[model samples]
Target: MGKEQEKEVILEQMEERAVEEISTHDAEKSIEEKLVAVQEEIAGYQDKMLRAAAEFDNYKKRMERDRNAAMKYAGEHILREILPVVDNLERALNQGVVSGVDAEMKLAALLEGVQLTLKSLLAVLEKFEVKAIESVGLPFDPNIQEALVMEPSDVVPASHVLGEFEKGYYYKDRLLRVAKVIVSSGKAAS
Candidate 1:
């Protein structure tokens, strides 16, 4: 239209572009700051995760070392107890070989020594919670007793244990060995 109006319109357009550029620059700066903050947060979280993973690895290693230590010395106490019994047996045998001792007297002494050693061994077993299962005169239990033979007995009733061949044993509430026993088949028919 008119020259004056055209110039005014061009100046207004230029001002608007300048204002738009400034606003766009401010928005870009804000976005860059937020992106940097998010990156820093991610890095912090990664560091924490790495630390936690390392801690777990250390825990596993500690437990493995403790388990190995336990396994290595697991039976130390029992072996220590058995050592005394071994010493007693050695002494008994040495006594049997002594000079000028009569054969019957030496034999009796040897037997007595062995009996005492056995009693000591039993006491040790009991201290460790090892127990003998009573099989004689009791009802036969398949869980703890193993029947080796069926015998006819006048004293023991049918399905009852008459005699034990080998004693059964328990170790602390767990069955260690089954008792070998003879089960009665009741009295003979008249």
Candidate 2:
């Protein structure tokens, strides 16, 4: 080849190489920018996830604290209801020893006060779903009645409750106390 032709060919090859290098550098820069943007996006999502998890944890703790507080004070209302009964008994005792009242009158007043207190207490218990179980004249039930004695009674049939020593009670459909009862064993032996 001639020297000038060789020079021209060499110049064309150099220009082509320069263009290819610039294109490769530009591609590398673009890829780097895309990678940085994707990393920033991922970091933002990670921050949001961390915050959400922390908030959920805080919410759970708050609920547990509330539940514990509720449990701690669960009997507060019932105790409050019973306080007045105590107060009434105190008043009755104080009145029983007054200087002007006679002994019989004082006793009557004390008994009346006690009856009223009992009625009030029973009302409170009923409000809380407690009730008395009627055992007398009803059939004896081992589930709710405990027989203390077997009596012969013409009035009450066999296997029936003749009397209750201590009355039974129910609290919200459940037997709170079993009745101590006298069960009839049928009519007296002829």
Candidate 3:
């Protein structure tokens, strides 16, 4: 309507444009900052991925090593278990139990042959990494010792092994059979 009013209105419009320009510049800067943060996050994720891949490779190698070791000692347990039987047979022969005099001679010869056979068998087992589990006078371990019975004992502590009824064998660290044992029961815990 009036020239002065028009000029005032024009000045107000110019001021509004300046404010919008400032806001646009701020928005552009914010967008750039956000892009930088997103890039940083992506870089961090990539680093984590690389670490995971490295860990997986190490795990594979470790597993392979364990597998090979298990394979190497696979037969050890069975052989170890059979060792006690050989020992028992040898003991029987040493005791010299027989019937007739002629039969006794034959039996003695048979026992000697059996002893030699057992020795040979044990030697073969030894080559395969088979080992016997120690059961006598030791603690009763459920992992290696199977409790045949709990018996009262004065010499051994309760829960300890009093005697091994049958021997256990191990192939490497794996148990083939648990040793059958009698466990000692202590003085009724008073």
lDDT at residue 144 of model 2 (Cα atoms): 94
lDDT of 1 by residue, 47-68 (tens): 9999999999999999999999
**Worst ten-residue run, lDDT, model 1?**
86-95
Worst 10 residues of 3 by lDDT: 92-101
RMSD of each: 2.9, 2.8, 11.3
Instruction: Report the C-alpha lDDT of model 2 over 2-79, residue by residue, as the tens digit.
Output: 999999999999999999999999999999999999999999999999999999999999999999999999999999
- Compared with the true structure, model 2 gives a TM-score of 0.81
Q: Note the clash tally of each candidate.
A: 0, 0, 3
Best by lDDT: 2
Question: On residues 68-183, what C-alpha lDDT tens digit does candidate 3 reach at each position?
Answer: 99999986887677776677666666556555457667677767767776776766666666688888888889978889899887789999999888889987778888899999
What is residue 81's positional error in candidate 3, in angstroms?
Answer: 2.2
Candidate 3 TM-score, C-alpha based: 0.46
Estimate the TM-score for candidate 1.
0.79
Which is the winner by TM-score between candidate 1 and candidate 2? 2
- Give the per-residue Cα lDDT of candidate 1 at 141: 96
Which pairs clash in model 1? none
| Candidate 3: residue 17 lDDT (0-100) | 96
